[model samples]
Target: MLELLSYDFMQRSLLAAALVGALCSVIGVFVVLRGLAFVGAGTAHAAFAGVALAYLIGFPPLPLAILFGLATVWVTGVMEEQGRMKLDVSIGILYTATMALAILFIGLMKTYNAEVYGYLFGSVLSVTSEELHIILVLSVLVLGLIVLFSKELYFIAFDQEMAEASGVPARRMYYLLLTLIALTMVVSLKTVGAILVFAMVLIPASTAYQLTHSLRHMTAYAAVIGTTSAVGGVLLSYAWDVPTGPAIVLLATAVFFGSVLFSPKRLRRIVA
Candidate 1:
């Protein structure tokens, strides 16, 4: 482990994993509370389309992912407003459609490259300093926004009707959260890929929820669990030469089950 840290790429991978894990878990609390798990999966698939587009056009993947993800966010919000599409249905269609398009684009590109598969499953060891900077900046921005709007978010999450009755901008907050989720999806793509991205965004928070009723406690615990899972997964994967993304998600799943098995909240509820 000490030898691993001595290498620049391993250090970068660890840093990226920590940042991505923290962001995913923090935001994932709201996602789980609001039942937006499907939306996270959809946004990840949309990000895959963005990456495919970027690869086909000879551009970087990150900006393209953000662009496509934000567009999907806006469109989904509009669909919700119009009462034209339920979230799960909309998300399902969007996810499959984008994934199909991404696959098609990859096939049409006429070149098979290892980087594509790396992006699909993750290649954190290949993360560059610039990518790290972007992840850091985005993580800070997302955390700050989440902090500033914690009250509103909590209200919106727990009681949308009450929040709106109390003059909270429910629609606005909904869109804001989706936009942030979109950004989260984009940044997380390089770490975990679209296929398993939602695991990072949902499992830790769900586990935390099992352990606590307070949003503050949930967020804190989720972040800790997520970071630990990511780091541990990376270390184990490095040692065993397994694929990183699924390994990380498997670690998160282990944590989720551990929390469920030992949750004081569950014990109290049972006793009550």
Candidate 2:
């Protein structure tokens, strides 16, 4: 592992995984608690569309994806706030539409690019220093927001009415949280791919959920689990010449299932 880190590509991959893991786990706690897992998937697909558009237009893909992701969050938040449409319906429609557009653009480009496939399935080994820098910045932004607003965010998460009653600007926090999720999805897309981004966002936090009843401790445990799984998966992929995204997700799934199998709650229920 030490020798592998000496290589620039490997170092970049590790750094990307570390940052992505932290971001995903942090945002995932809210995603799970708020029942917004679908939103994460939607934003991920939306980001993919942005990448495809970037490819067609000859711009940097990550930045384009992030921009698209932010837009998606805004639109979805507006629709949700208006209550003119159900949140799931809005997300499903937009998610499919954007993903379809991405596919169309990819075909129109008339190039079967390995880089495109790598993004779909992850080539963390191919992560550029520039991309890693973007991930680092985004991670800081996310952590900063979470730290600054954790009390209010938690109140909103637990009881939106109470949060609003307390002058927490719950709506603003809601949109802000969505925006953070968009950023998190965009950053993790390269490491875990759009298809498996949900795994990264949900698995570690779910496992932590099983281990703890406290939100703070659960968040900490989730971050640790996510980072460990990402790094381990990447190392395993490197050693075995396997795909990185699936490997990482599989590791997360393993942890999730392990938690379910061994959860004390389940055991107590069984005994009763």
Candidate 3:
């Protein structure tokens, strides 16, 4: 393990995994509280579609991914807010459409693209120094914005209607949450891949929920769990010669089940 850390690429991979994991888990708190799990999955597919198109066109994938992810979430939010369609319905439609788009884009490519598959299944062990810097900058920006708007975000997450009643700009805050989620997904695409990134976002936060009811404490616990999972996953994957993304997610899943088994709420229920 110590020998692994001496390698520059391993250091970069660990740093990238930690940043991506922390960012995903923190944003995931609001996502879980707001009941937007489906949105996470949907935006991932949309972002992947953008990546596919970018590869086909010989363009950068990051901006295109951000564009697609943001578009999907905003459209879903608008539909739900306008009562035009239920949130799940809109997300369900977009989810399938985006995945189909990804497939179509891949089919259009004349040759097999191993690099594109990297984005699909994740290759955190291959993270470059440049990508590490990108991950760091975005992680800081997102985490900072989260701190700046923490109170309002929490308000909207738990009770948007009441927050709006109190003039908290709940609608705008809701959109901001969606935007954050999209950005988080896009930033994490390389490290965790499109298919498994949602697990990175959802699992740590969900596990934290099993341990605490207080929002602040839950967020703190989730960050720790997520970081641990990412770092630990990278280490284990290297040692075992396994996939990094699945390893991270599986570790988090184990923690989640452990939390559930010993949850205070569950114990209280049993006592009663």
Candidate 4:
């Protein structure tokens, strides 16, 4: 296991996992709090469409995926605000449309591209140095934005009406939060893939949610859990010759179940 670091690809994969894990879990706190887990899933599938579109048009997939994800979330937010549809319904519509687009684009290709499979199921072991750099830069950007807007985000997450009453710019903050989630999804694409990325976003934060009521504590705990799962999964994948994304998600699920079984909050509620 120690000797695996000697390989450059292994080093990149570990770094990618750690960064993606931490960022996804941090954003996931808000996702879990707002009941927007479906949003994450929607954005990830939308990004898959973007990836397929990029492949079709001969462009870089990450940037295009980011655009696609942001567009999807923005549309969802707009529809919800306009009272045109419920958020979940809007998300479901976009999710299916984008997934269909991805399928169509892939089908149109003259030859099957194995790389697309990597995006679908993850290929962290094949992470390139450039991809690692992008992940690092985006992780820093996402974390910084979160810190800068911590109070507003907290207010909006817990009580949007109250936040708006308090002049917290709730609507703007809502869109901003969605945008951040989209960006995080894009950055996480390679490490966890489109299909499994929502697990990274949901499981860690959900686990943390079971353990704590404080948003700060929840975020911190989620980050730690996400990081641990990602690193541990990578190691297990290496040892077992399994797919890295599912390995990471399974570890996260295990942690969540563990938290559910022994959560102090749950125990306190029961005892009371």
Candidate 3's residue-wise lDDT over 13-132, tens digit each?
999999998999999899899999999999999999999999999999888999999999999999998999989999999999999999999999999998888889999988888888
Residue 2, candidate 2: C-alpha displacement in angstroms? 3.5
Model 3, TM vs. native: 0.99
- The 10-residue segment of model 1 with minimum total lDDT is 110-119
Give each model's whole-structure lDDT: 0.88, 0.87, 0.93, 0.93
Model 4 over residues 1-272: C-alpha lDDT tens digits? Answer: 78899989999999999999999999999998888989999999999899998998899998899999999999999998899898899999999999999999999999889888788898999989999999999999999999999999988889999999988899999999999999999998888999999999999999999999888899999999999999999999999999899999998999999999999999999999
TM-score of 2: 0.96
lDDT of 1 by residue, 5-67 (tens): 999989988999999999999999999999888888888889888898889889988888898
Work out the TM-score per prediction. Answer: 0.96, 0.96, 0.99, 0.98
Q: What lDDT, from 0 to 1, does candidate 4 have?
A: 0.93
Q: In model 2, which runs have C-alpha deviations exceeding 4 angstroms? A: none
